[model samples]
Target: MTKESTPNDVTLAEPIEQEVEAHSEDNKVSEQEKKKFEKREKERKHLVSKLAQGNMDHLLTRVASVLNHYQETRNSDITLQTRYWEVFQSDIYNGSVIDPKDMYKLERLTSIARARAKIQNEFKMFLADEEVQVSRRSRQETEKEIQLATKPEIPLISMYCDESGKTGNFAIVGSLWVINKARQTQVRDHFSKWKTEKGLSAKDEFHFTEMKKHQLDLYKEFFDEVIKNSDALGFKAVVVDKTKIKRPIDEIIMDLHYQVVHQGIEHEVSNGRLALPRIVNFFKDEEDGQEALYETKLKQHLHSQFRLAFDDQLTLDLFNSVPSFQNVYIQMADLYTGCISRVLNHPKQGEGNHKDHFAEYVLELLRLDLGAKNDQSQDFAMVHFFE
Candidate 1:
């Protein structure tokens, strides 16, 4: 058919059809791209969530197992299994994207498992060795008893003393006795009576002036009682921190030693009286001004004290083959003291309130319990391990 050729119609028809087609194709392509992107984003989120869940579960399991093993064996050398160690290294320690093959190295896995097993076996051996030694020591004591006419009782005392301030405050002196049943009862009764008579209550204070007075009163009362009972009970060496003494440190040490001798002679308990000292002193220098410096010093001091007090070498070699005591002596020079000092030095920085919060946060971190929520979560995780 011969159509009438209108100039406007011929110009518009083909291009409009083509333009509509192109626009539709572009929309379709855009929709497809959007779908792909959404799918990938969803997958990424899902994978992250799954990995996080797995990491949490693994960490909980491993920590619980390690803790339980430590409790059962009383060994600090307990280790995690290979698979668990890999999980820790990958998820918790490294915080990296881990591949499937990286998760399983046969040799590494075997080594970790063997290490854990060896640690467990070694701990068991240690316990057995200790028991054997204890039995042998008992036998030796029995053998030695036959040579002596009468056995002399070992005199021991446990003292817990705390000082308030380095220079300005007084010291709180708390003493307890570890003795025969009869003596414990007597001492307990005496303490009760004294508490009632003096109306003494255990209240902690920060003001040096007030603390000093309170400590002085407590010391006086304690000294009087000890003096009165000196004839019946022999005295032992004092346990005290050598920091922040009103008197010179050396003088305090010597005085305590002399008191032990005096008490021994008065009671006529033994011929050779020796002062077995337990002293707590920190390494002080100019570098100990920063927080990190203080932390390092604190750790070093605590470790040294723990080794000296509870480790085998010091107890066995220096103390005439005496077994080490399990209980460790903890110094009272904690972050609370630091806070107080900071408050005293700079009252303008809201130091009084903030310092305590900072100290508490540091303590929480040390305990691996960030807050109450973390503590509860940890307990739940621990329960899972047992199951």
Candidate 2:
């Protein structure tokens, strides 16, 4: 019952031919990819060689933190890679040597947006390793528990900021300045006592527009306290007039924020106000897609304007915190800005909102120059107007 195969039939030759051709195709593709990768590596090495001669201190000293806050998990390779390239370019621009491993890391870090948290963790671990090595060189370490117990935390000037009416004609950034560690706890305790006396929880949130009808008095008391202690604890605001701007809303907002923050920090240092070991400015997380790009840009502008202009001695940390958390300081910014927005935007609202009244009343209380522009550096607040 066996039948002999026909000569025209494929038998094994067609599959064998097809597989050989496929193999050849694969080899061709792999060769091409290898050539492309090599070319890219060569170009990167060339760039790094050129960049190694310049100022590399920014690489070791400057901190780039991304919160991975955009909420989207899908990796955007093109954008991320472009950012990595940007980071690589900056490393060289700052005169840092580009090792193969770091270039590889840059490739990995820039390839996926979700890798932000992982990158930060790895960076932290790297810093920790460096600390261990430095300690080893100086002296032998004790057990892990002992080391952990002895680790000291460096105190910093914490600046909590929030913005309101971002899309409206007026944008305001309000800031609450506080010292970290024990002093912060003391201030929080005082604020909490005021809240408890007003029949509110210490954990209760404070927002002006959403205040209950009876909470008006509580709001007034809090504002008065801020104004009263405006010396020991500080609150400041920078306003932007958007009606005069011709750019898109998002662009305008980012630029104004940068200018406000930039000018604000400079205003502080110029006046001998930023007298702490370091400064950490926390703003609400706004950019979901371009968090890394935006954070890097902001930090660069701050460093360029404030740090480089001086001795690069100042350490500025920019971080993003969720707006709806237990950040009482950010709430302070929101409450302060809410008051400013009401008075500045609704000049015609007769019988002003008490928050607005409090704002204007504070100006009178401090005797700020009514005739002078708000942009003038006052002892308490400095406002920036875009020309």
Candidate 3:
């Protein structure tokens, strides 16, 4: 400062000192930035680790709940039971202790168990209600007072016979309801209705033809009604007119026997035996011409194991002993003949027509057979006889 310095020296000295100070400042700022960045990176890593741990815990809890639910719902002997046990054992091996937060998962599982138990209880209640209703209805029927005649030692069996006339166009059905006391009023009233609804008024050919169809329909209707009243009437047996429909009858009989065996109807009867009355068909007469041929073929097709023969004495005796039999026998001789006649008269319709008609007959026969056997035997005694 005392000696006057040169302008160049002064300029050089000032520039060097300022440059050093600026470099020192830049170094300090870089060191501070590095420390801040390292701290932020460490915090991010810690947060990611915590989030990953939480997700893993949540997944494990859900898995445990599902496994517990499966074990509870599955059958005791099922393979799933073993599998769940294995998983539980593995979890215990790894770490038996569960975190307090996982207790909620266990609670969720318990809730599901409670809901399942409630559903089971509701289902049982529903079943009980249904059983109560059935019992009430049965009790009402049993308590009703009605004058029922003492059942004969040998039950009365009636025979209902029917036949089809010329070309199977006309059907004739006859019912012999055997009454031991012979209620003339009941018989007269019933016959009057039957004759009006099913019988041919004029003996003319045309009237007879119409009567045949009417008779068949009426027979079916009557048979169904009698069956419905069988329990109330205390009938021992309900004999269906098998006759030309032996094949159909056999099929129905077999089905009834099957139902009795498989469906527990036998256990419901008085003697643990289903007491479906015996069903038999009249032997077809050879003198019946083509009708006889039809009967023979039908028997062969339906029950090849048995042979058919008409014995007038047997038929007459059976008819007369209706009072000794359980229920009435229904005959569809007229309906069968009429169907045959219709088929023969209309031959141009092709073979399918006969097949269709026969199939329909078989189906109807099956339905009737099943209906008769349904709940008919309480003791299911028929099982021993047939099985």
Candidate 4:
């Protein structure tokens, strides 16, 4: 049934075979091109992923870009329809092609991505602006410190002190600070002028205990000067309850004095009320009843403490024991501390007398509550009670 091929039949079959071979070669080239395209696409996706790593702002921006591109292309009905048909023709989508519902979701996601990217950019800009502001503030602060450091010498401030009620239920130690030489001169001159006007001699003592009932108005007038000069003056006190003494009162008194002084200076400097590297001149009411070497020991101890706290930056310029009657500022310290001690220990000592009324007046002026410990940041006053 099969016939043998002749020479003419063989020649015709040869062209057909050659055509088949050419078609096969063409298919091989097409397959190679397809592989190359797929590889390029994979590389591009890897590159995008690499660029987006560890940078949320960049990642969000890239996602927004891709979403925006798709949304723009899908906006045209012709392009949308063509892509839809193409997807159906290919096996990439299988039987589940993205429908109108999915396209609507894709649009919503694109809008959200764009919003997120905008917010990320704004937030990044906000953080950058904050860093710049912080840097500027730091520079200004550094310049201020440099200016303070370049002064020829540290500013000298004086502290006058007094203690009262040492033998009573509460021992009160109070101090007044004249922060500069000008303020010191102003306060002393004012006191001297006021005394001269009142027909009082330079040797007259303004002891709170000796004040009579008729002298209440004069005392109030004197205190008015104190309140007026509050800007250049500061006050601090430490009260120790005699009933709670574990250590000797003498030892505790020395430590408490140091505490009040050191803490007051530290607080003022830190709050920008006082500058650093100050020279403090300390003067206390002479303790004639104490041991002969008490003043010397206290001075040594205070200097040692200052050296530890501030090294050589802060210096104890002078330490002396002076008579309270000779110095109006020391008398002022005495009056303030005496009032506080009397109120806390014996509020009824001179009830209905000028002393009681004056004590009440002092309390009102300073805004101090006797029973509760008072220490506030806004005011340069502290009354700490060690129970």
The lDDT for every candidate, in the order shown, is 0.32, 0.52, 0.31, 0.64
Give per-model CA RMSD.
24.6, 15.4, 35.1, 34.3
Number of clashing residue pairs in every model? 0, 3, 28, 0
For model 1, the superposed segments whose C-alpha errors exceed 4 Å read 1-157, 163-185, 198-223, 230-271, 274-387
lDDT of 1: 0.32
Measured with C-alpha atoms, the lDDT of residue 173 in candidate 1 is 20
Candidate with better TM-score, 1 vs 4:
4
TM agreement with the true structure for every prediction? 0.24, 0.55, 0.22, 0.58
Q: Output the number of the lDDT-best candidate.
A: 4
Candidate 3 per-residue C-alpha lDDT over 14-92 given as tens digits, one digit per residue, 9 for 90 to 100: 9899999999989999999888768755543332232211121332232322222232222211222223333343443
- Cα RMSD for predicted model 4: 34.3
Minimal lDDT window, size 10, model 2: 65-74
The sequence of per-residue lDDT tens digits that candidate 4 reaches over residues 47-125 is 3232211112343433322222222221222322323333223333323466664454332344443443343243221
Candidate 1's displacement at residue 273, Å, is 3.3
List the candidate numbers ranked by lDDT, top first. Answer: 4, 2, 1, 3
Candidate 2: where are CA atoms >4 Å away? 1-155, 179-182, 270-272, 285-311, 353-355, 358-373
